[model samples]
Target: MRETLLLLSGFVLLSSSTNLDVLLHQSVPYSPQSASTEQAWIASLESTHTETKAQTTSTVEGERVHGSMTREMKRQYEIAAYRRTKAQARSTPTATPSPRVATLNPIFDKQDIEPEHRVIADQAFRIIPGHCQAFLKNFYVRYDNPQHRGLGGKSTIILTGSVPDEEFRALFFHELGHLTDLGCFQGTAVAGSTPYMDKDEQIWKDDPSVSFYQISWMNSQAHNRGTTEEDFVSGYASWDMFEDFAESFVYYVLHREVFARRAAENDALAAKYQWFQEHLPDLPKVAKSNTRWDGAIPWDITKLSYDWKPPTELVARR
Candidate 1:
């Protein structure tokens, strides 16, 4: 019986030793420093980062890539924005577009026809639809909210912001874009605002990566900026149709006009059309002419000489 007990004890000892070895050799790290495990994990992280950067670089490469990307994004944003405004218009349950054309209050409807003629006939003649009225945003009063009285009324679409006098007509063309977007003549209200700035390629190269996600992403990079008017600086870039249309309209206005200015200090503006042409692919050649963004109204290079004309009779204030 003593011998049997000794054999049994030996067997138990053997089993315990085997179990200890198994645990020590388990699948997880057994090394003293675990240096290999850490190295493998780091390698994985580096690979992932490299892949992501490569993807970013690949996405933004092509001919006129910058302009193409900007235009495509702006169009995408415009579609979505219009939808939002459509919803708002429906939600408000306001007045409908008159089936028949109605006369506008001259001051409210619009008093200045000269600017319209300039933008259409001289400036950005390529973009101006025939019989374009820098129509008033009169109907928008129902839905218009006083958010940013940056320069004018909540719905009041002013002709120019803080730009020089010579540029007001072109600038007015930009505001006209806001007017057009706000159902100025379409008789339909815009659903939302979409701000898209397409800076020159050289300009973008300095900062790099103006991704739409910077504006549209759930946690947009545009949301976090260092500025006193952070909301305007960040959200403004993506929020308002007024900005997008205005900027695009501005391109139509002063695109080659900048060249005209340089013609005095540098090369002829006409010669620079080729450079501008490289920027806009969708537009026609004639649309690219340097004179297109000019006007019948003589431009005062210093400041706006708009003599305060008496408000037109049609301009009946509500």
Candidate 2:
């Protein structure tokens, strides 16, 4: 048996054997300048104005109102105006901050990752929809864990070791699948073994993924309930619903037409394809590929072609 690592708060780990991903946690609260501080500043400016006005009245009473003002009074008036200007600037609302873009931060031991590999990884990242990509923070590429191909967390992805360019792309997409499942459709947390709510703010049980899960699994543990090998995209997917979603996600991206042909033969696959079409319609499609659905499903879908619609084409689609 593979060694099981414990799940950490705000992060999830994905191993070759199982997928244990989590929802993106809430961001740190941004505390603007306190209201009381603004009020205090305003009050101080008012006090200064009152004093300046009173001095001006007393000093100018027996002389010309503007020309007889003392140097100190002029300086005070200028300071008061400056303070008023600052207060107004502070109170003015700023434009909302733009969302953070996902970045690939390689923690490799030698930093010898090939330029072509980086391009492949970038292409895979762009393949994900823009909205879904917004939820991601960092894609860490590390060489420490050679055994695990990829791992995913709330708003992060970890691609381990190195493989062929196509395999690297696929592995990244597989982990991205986990990120999309957890982050993109993240909902409220509830009390139970199924802790997350779906996109509709209901329990995780009602999630659209659950609908796909129901096609093969009676529950997470009981797999012998009516579903057959043909029903799943790959043997790994049959392991559990999380893997099912992730594996199917890769298939939908790398082999959409092949998957569509297979889906025609199997109603279960057709439904899964439909699920992707309906729920994740914005994902980029493969522009060119020679992969066919006639053979047995490959255990690793990432080992396939790397061709996909470029970011420019994807933008046009939107």
Candidate 3:
């Protein structure tokens, strides 16, 4: 009887780790919105390995501020600015209660982690290594319509545990880049410099059309250009400002010396790098040694999942 049970367990694990494509085809159908997000995520992933194709069909959602500026994106930016104000508020004794620690459900027991790898996870926005694809099975999503039920607030950093240190570092910053877009935190830092942006002026106050991303030279290959023409830190930065920030943030955080040297050559890149130094003043200079991203995660493109689904159901019943 014990042998039978052990066999059953092994089969379950094998199916999950190896049969993802089969599972996706048999699983819940993808909502258009969720599909779009999945496509964007996949594109971003592909960009790490190859030049990503332009996503002309992908639409940016928000109230139109001007040509491409949207109020929705501006609101996301406002949230980050608000977080700064809230951080300041917390400095006072009478400030509101601190936010609850971020919740995570990892397949590996935290009690089993070595001290060093655990530290790396915390610094990288509480990243938890697990089967990211299977994790999605727990949620329901409708991506195309905001009126349709879906998750809210949080974004995901999808990676398998076995990723190498360099790639893991890249993925960590990439997700943080998405978080920066939500205005959850300041997007820049310097070792000991003054705060990067105009504290008095809100970022959302400016016309979005005039932002640094509007520069004509920025494109899918922006990262490949010489420092003079490249406003982004890597090729992935060309995806969007959100991606640009994430790619740049990783470079700024992991390769501070390199970032500083390059910043000297480009005014726009310099300003972006300076934000991390000034705003996140206390961030450590480098990831701890012995950091291991060894957890394995299965991939499925069609699954409907999100980190934070709104409580209200947004879909209409037939």
Candidate 4:
């Protein structure tokens, strides 16, 4: 039995097919909504809605104070004034919750992770049935060749007895990407249907010079000496959209420094800067103002990684 090195929590360990043991424990909670509080919330919502309508009427009437303005022009003026006033009112501003950074939980080495991560993990799990807090299965994915320990099949994820919280979360997200591909977590891509599986091989072939064997402009020792760019990069990229998706998510949420670096080099990253300007929730007004684009993603058309950008709309969302 070959012991493959795996990372769990932040600790590294060696394990093999025969010795790997996965504990099955999910930390899902059933925090049902309270009815009395819900009713109060509904009442509050109704009051706010009523006030909004009343304010709209008052603003419209106030605009009529100037008869010469056309209806559209008057509406624009009111909107602009309302926004200016609102902006001023919010001058002192409010602190926003930071984007949750996925951290390595040391307790996983001791098998003591709290339910907080499990809760977030479920969001990705909710995309797939028969998948819960974390899942494991020994099956091959298109990105990977068949291995003694892998993920595939109808149910359960395989764990090697020692899954650290952060690594576990990474693997959970990694597998979740596969689940996402299955239309389980994110899409309705029928198994073996989407054409994305071969995207990297196609891209690396198109640009063997830059991608094939470059050292991590970020890391000095990433590339092996004398490794041909075509072989190294082509193999490194490995039609693995799973890794791409995971890398993209990690860069977006945690390694934003890398995101910034990529955006500078690749036009696709620039497009993502613009795209994220429009989509990322909870950004400060200042950062929102910094994006130079409005309608399209800022990255270059060819180099933009799909994981870095949101999917283009295929059908009108009705």
Clashes of each: 16, 0, 19, 21
RMSD of each: 34.7, 13.2, 27.5, 19.5
lDDT of each: 0.29, 0.59, 0.36, 0.31
Q: Write the per-residue lDDT of candidate 3 for residues 1-318, one digit (tens) a residue.
A: 000001122122122233222112111111222212211112343345553233212223333233333557556656766786798888967856434333333421144333333334443443222222232222122222332121111232223233334443344444444344333432332322221222222233232211334332343233334443255565445444444554565555555565666678777778777666664555555432222112221121112111221112111100
- Find the number of clashing residue pairs for candidate 3: 19
Quality of model 1 by C-alpha lDDT: 0.29
Weakest 10 consecutive residues of candidate 2 by summed lDDT: 30-39
Q: Which structure is stronger by TM-score: 2 or 4?
A: 2
Tens-place lDDT digits, model 2, residues 11-91: 233332333333321111111111111011123433444444533443222334454456786676667667877989999
lDDT of 2 at 314: 42
Model 4 bad stretches (over 4 Å):
1-120, 123-161, 184-239, 268-318
Which is better, 1 or 2, measured by lDDT?
A: 2
lDDT-superior candidate, 2 or 3: 2
| TM-scores for every candidate against the unseen true structure | 0.25, 0.59, 0.36, 0.28
TM-score of 1: 0.25
